[model samples]
Target chain A: MSFREKIHWVTLVTMILAFGWYFLVYPWRIVASPAGVMATAGMLVPVTIAIIVAMTVATAFLAIRSPREVHAREDERDRNIHMRGTHFGYYPLVVGIWINIFLIFWGIGQAEQLNLMIATLVVAEIVRIGTQLYLYRRGY
Target chain B: MAKPPFTNDIRTLRFLAGEMTQGDLGDRVGVTRQTIAAIEQGKYSPSLEVAFRIARVFGKPLEAVFQWDDAGD
Candidate 1:
């Protein structure tokens, strides 16, 4: 596998794990004050930051280890595949965010959308990586 | 994997041209040896610039080095 492909796999798997943790196992520590605090997804903000930092470190290590599998430059075909994947990645969020607005008007709160938004972001990235892998394997 | 779009006699041509090694051809053309291998196996095709480069190294025309067939695409 090429360096970029290996990086793609590492980033792909890391993001999948991070996404699941952010939306699933991430602890949302509730804080209380005179203003009062409610138990919700607030804990995720810090946890997600930590997750991102950790994954970035891991990916950087992988990149440093294998310089050749990594592409210093892209050939024509690589750029073409990137464009296709970018289009597909953005489409999901357009539908997702618009529907989110619709739901808010129908009385669903912002908190309800938080998990969905995180999920969409994760799935979008997964789709992006999958598209890259697919294009690499299947041709541009 | 995509079948190579072009067929080449690079291996034979190289041999005919004073037994060129993959490294020699790659260095002459400014790409890595792996790329040369990929091109030879029909797993990858070089860019026009790279193709022309490979041809020029042997003092041949572009067509003499790389053959493109649309059927693969």
Candidate 2:
């Protein structure tokens, strides 16, 4: 596989694992103080730091293994695939933001609204990465 | 996967051109080897500029390299 493809797989895996741990295992509601709301959210600072470190290591390894491919320029096909994936990604982000706005109009709680916003952003990123992988495997 | 309406003779041309590797052709054409493979396998239709560039690499006209299949579409 190309270096970019390998990077895609690594990022996708890391994103899923990190987000999965936060959403599935981290206890968000344990600390309910207003000031601690974001701190106690599913995505804690420590988890974010861990993910950053993991990604840095993975990228370093990839660059070391294939320095030539890492520096290679992206060509027409790569640009086309990126454009297509971004087009698909845009729809989810717009829809998510619209839903978040509707929730605000409906007078949802502050914490719930924040949660929805975070979830929407995560889903949008998933859509972007998922679509890129699909286009890479299939054809543009 | 279903084949695209466009078909190319890249594999045969590469073979005739001193058994050019996919990577070599991709390098000349400014694309990834995977993209070259995809085009040869009839799974992808390259853009106009890329198609012209591939033809130029083989010293052939674009029509000689790629043919449109009206029936396939």
Best by lDDT: 2
Fnat (0 to 1) per candidate = 0.14, 0.64
Find the 10 residues in a row with the least total lDDT in model 1 chain A. A30-39
lDDT digits (tens) for residues A1-140 of candidate 2: 77887887887888788777767764456433454356445356766787799889999999999887887788777887778778888888899889989988997666666666767777877788888888788876
List ranges where model 1 is wrong by over 4 Å: A26-41, A67-71, B1-5, B10-47, B70-73
lDDT of 2 by residue, B1-73 (tens): 4778878899999999999999899999999888899899876778899999999999999989998898887
- Model 2 per-residue lDDT at A119: 71
B1-73: candidate 1 lDDT, tens digit per residue: 6677678878988999999998789777776565677678776666788888888888898888777778766
Candidate 1: which pairs clash? Answer: A3-A69, A3-A70
For candidate 2, chain B by itself scores a TM value of 0.92
Clashing pairs in 2: none
Q: In candidate 1, residue B60 scores what lDDT?
A: 90
